[model samples]
Target chain A: MGVIIAKSLNEACVVLAENPATTVLAGGTDLMVQANRGMQSMDSVLDLSRILELKEWTLKDSEIVLGAGISYTDLAEPQIATVVPALAQAARTVGSPQIRNAGTLGGNLATASPAGDTIPVLVAMDAVLQLKSSSGNREVAITDFITGVKSNALQAGEIIQSITMPVFQGPQEFLKVGTRNAMVISVVSLALVTDYLGRKLRVGVGSVSPVPFRATEAEEFISQEFDWEKNSSLSEKVINKFSDMVADSTKPIDDHRGTADYRKHAVGILAKRALERVCANGES
Target chain B: MTSEIYTLTVNGNDYQILDGHPSESLLWVLRERLELSGSKNACEEGECGSCTVLLDGEIVCSCLVLAASAVGREIVTIEGLGSGNEISDVQQAFVDAGAVQCGFCTPGLLVAIDQLLNTNPDPDDLTVREAISGNLCRCTGYGRILEAVRIASNSRTVQNEEEKGK
Candidate 1:
């Protein structure tokens, strides 16, 4: 059987409560491909695209709450672009205008693809995942949200309502090395958010592991030993420990995109380049 | 399965259609149900912009768009470009610029370029490149494809002046 279109979130929850055998469709960045290949085994689907309530990006104090169904096209507007340029850059990097128009942050989190463009950026910016069920709502840090590959802390009958994050310090850099530029998935992607400056320098890396991660060790190393202005031996220290630390944190494999070694090398290059940019930013 | 009827406005005309499910993709509805073959189904996964169409004054891949979700939205396909006889300035520019090679990805390209020129009448080369980065044409080197955008934008200017003269 096909799916039923739930006009509202309440109706969708009722559908989930009664018949939990439904797959929820937001942006079909991941779902449509799975459905075409007959991988998604749900007998029914709850189409949340029609639910207007699930599509808003608003500001609550310092937090920018992007609705579960908001498309990159919606976020590409000039006003929305100012929220977070790096996040916007991540959104623009998705695939193309069509992919951006169709994909959702909700689907990205739900699918939990390691190469999910926005995930690393969110991780760097200390974003939160807001999941809502028929019973109530709950929020989890993005770091604690994903448990494993394609497995998350989400319980049954729960759907990601929106993703919330404070508008972090800017001039942030988000870079990914892919096969091509626009459409191809990343070999490795890195997001550097200097929200704290001397307070903290958060670095998020994706496609190098089962889950995108912030290199806490590397962050500590930079904070303690390094100064961007003076003569820096920390570059050598960072390069020395970065490869192993980044590789140790990741669980990459030989996929059609690349091999584990290539991923490791990419991770190292990404790290050095990212910190180099940070240093450059500091210089500026 | 329960079906939902939605009023879809295509180009300028409005048509009511039955959707097997409200969540069904508009690409399938447009290609299979409505028989609008202008947009090809290259990568039904929304990677290739072969299925690109303008949805409610913006560009989107029809493959990833839900059929029932498109209700009450204005859709502009390549077929909607010109009046009755003459092709649109952008479409003509594509032809004049020799942008088409295999012609498979042309319709989506035309739609994409048409939308880009509407927003940025005089765009730089980089802007033109970024705007249509969604629509991929593997045949043409994309040099000529971008040239067509510039050509089309120039055509819009000349046509405006001609009308002003009358």
Candidate 2:
């Protein structure tokens, strides 16, 4: 076994280009666990923690570009929380303080778990991922990046460089159901973002499908029904209908964590609560 | 297969890992190679914080950290908590509060509480609970552990005041 600690992004890319089979280690929260359990073999490893470029974040105008190595603890900081409250809320719910301090945004994106706490928030914000390799860089939407459970569209020698999301001035909420309040994987999660400038509401649902997806039908229904000018609330019937539509969009499965029926039901309830918290003014 | 030698800075001392495999975890290297058994190894995974150690001043599960990745980083295990032969204030508070039962989770809990107090000297109950949520104590049911944190915080406040008087 060999380990190469790359001090910069260029060095890391060169290493990856030379040997595409090298296992990239960032934070190592997920990969090391697999290695400990004999589930993953590391013939060669590329440690990315020393790369200074991946640890930085930039805010340009109305968009925020978070470096791939930004930890969940950093994401929940006041600097990012004010701009992306839902992402901060989701980051705060991931694992525990120890995990959050070590787990990076790029690690979460690379894991591509359907039950990942932060993915739904990223999807709702329509985040674009910057993938870089020795050859060049490419951008992919969050929806197109995650292909299935524990699967992603990352090619060999490619690394998630940064995640870019547009800042919006509206109420945002991230809600999830887990067995325990802390240190538990989400059973079902939902993120709701209100785009006041565009007069559109976005909804992202997770843990109930193969990939975290936007509840487009429910978003469309609520966006059409709710009055954006006055920022009025929706009736109880409308909320319920929107929740049902969100539930109908899922393709859940019965797993050790939860049953398909329970996941669908929980996701709908999460969607409903998220909408009420974000959009419900005083009516319902 | 060739074994590579790497130097790890633990508890202000540099130890050369001559027999460690590249895939070995930091927890394994700490306990097996360096003989720092104070950092308990309960769950090899990150779920149980029994193997918690401060890597570069941030508490993380040593089991989830690759030993090779931690070459140049500073690591503080439970053995490095106190100065000289004296147990730290938090460790003494745990003994005073009877927070140790079976004692598997004590080291991790102490490290977590130490970090919490370092950041926030006087944390509320919710803050304390959230701070130590990663550590799982099957014994004491967390009642004594929480009590230990309170005792540590109070003593630290008194100590701070005394230092200010000087």
Candidate 3:
């Protein structure tokens, strides 16, 4: 296969415009697996690994703009971990040390796997993706960009440049349940970002739906029931009701990793536990 | 298929391959063209760290790295850890702790431990487990492997203090 090493983001876009069908190789964690399995055959590839501009993150206004090329290893940086703990926690659960070292958050979103560990966290944080092409640039929300399972709204000649999300001020938690402890795909993952000052919370769920989604209805219910100023603890009844709402929102299907019933049950348990942890440890 | 010439530095040696493809995995080039078979091809996928190598001092699965993409980068494979006939401290620890059974997974484990100890000489049990979690060993049950890492870490600490005293 022909591969062009683009040293800069502008060079990458120009090459992409010329070879729109060429595969974009970022970290190659997912694409290389397909190539090794004979699942993908490509005539040309655009290697973005050499582009330095795509590897550095920046803080703009009140949001953190992470370059699409930032690896999971970068997510563990103290600055990123403090601002986006859920994303860091999700990155930690990605694969093993080797996988995290090479895998990029941009690659994870581009793959659009429903079971992607970081997708739920991105959705919870309302992350925005910047897609660049020779023509121009456009921004899309994480939910809209990830159209379906193993699919995204990436246009021809376009590549993900970076992802931006508002800085979260409250406590955030990410929880994933897999068959084994490490190096396993998520059966159901949940991310909770609690805004105690705002008297509300944001919930993002993955693997239990066609796309990772926010538990809006569940969030509305809990926010209404929660007394932001006075209540120090959540009642057992409220936790049960919130968990039930989260389970009810999912539209899961049976697959090799888990059954629909198990996914739903697991999501409920994860939601309850995540909410409890946030309530117990959230900042006032 | 048209072939591409890719140049890379592996284990302190410079190499240029005429038949390396940009899409071909680094694991294939290492095992086939360069004859560095120390990095095993257990799972061509990234799930198994059998093809683990140090890419710019960071551990990454060679199976997931494209040979062309690795051009101008530094890579350290299992065969590059020691000079000539002498083995690295981590490898010696594996032998002393009886960490080898079938020995198929030994090379990857040795590379992983070598990288881990370089960064953290005194890692806890959880750190050791996390370091080698990508590597799967069906024969040793990982008990001796943990012990081997602990032994290597202790030995390195002792050697470092001696050097400092001198």
How much is the lDDT of residue A3 in candidate 2?
89
Q: Proportion of native contacts found in each model?
A: 0.47, 0.70, 0.72
Model 3 spans with C-alpha error above 4 angstroms: none
**Residue-level lDDT tens digits of model 1 in B10-106:** 8788877865554456777777777888888887777778888998777888877766656667898878888898998888888898998998889
Against the reference, the lDDT scores of all candidates come to: 0.78, 0.91, 0.90
lDDT of 2 by residue, A1-284 (tens): 48889999988999999999889999898999899998887768999988989989988899999999999999999999989999999999988899999999999999999988899999988999999999999999999999988999999999999999999878899998988877888889999998888888899988988889898988899989877777677789998999999999999999888999999999889888988888653233
Task: Give candidate 1's TM-score.
Answer: 0.89
Model 1: which docking level applies? Answer: acceptable
lDDT of 1 by residue, A206-265 (tens): 988889988887767655655634423456666567546655666668999999888887
lDDT of 1: 0.78
Residue pairs whose backbone atoms clash in candidate 3? none
Taking the tens digit of each residue's C-alpha lDDT, what string does model 3 give over A1-284? 48788999999999999978888999999999998887886458888987888888887677899999999988977889988899999998888999999999899999999999999999988999999999999999999999999999999999999999988667789999997777989999999987765677899999998899999999999989876775567899999999999999999999999999999999999999998888777535
Prediction-by-prediction clash tally: 0, 0, 0
Model 1 error, position A233 (Å): 10
Two-chain DockQ for model 2? 0.73
